[model samples]
Target: MSSLKTKEEGKVTQREILGCLKNCLLLLSD
Candidate 1:
């Protein structure tokens, strides 16, 4: 059960990182 929760958190962190990277790219392009 704990492992499953950790995996979910990790996925969320990855998504957040991707979102930040995309925003950074957009700003740089502008």
Candidate 2:
């Protein structure tokens, strides 16, 4: 791939996005 990225890095990004999404949902629910 031209972009260049490691699997571990992808996993970490996914986790951060998920955490942000979870926090947003919680705030909306309240």
| lDDT of each candidate versus the true structure | 1.00, 0.88
- Model 2 per-residue lDDT tens digits across residues 2-26: 3455777888999999999999999
* TM-score winner: 1
lDDT: worst 10-residue window of model 1: 1-10
Tens-digit lDDT track for model 1 on 1-24?
Answer: 999999999999999999999999
Give the per-residue Cα lDDT of candidate 2 at 5: 56
The clash tally of candidate 2 reads: 0
**Which ranges of candidate 1 are over 4 A from the true structure?**
none
For model 2 the local lDDT of residue 7 reads: 72
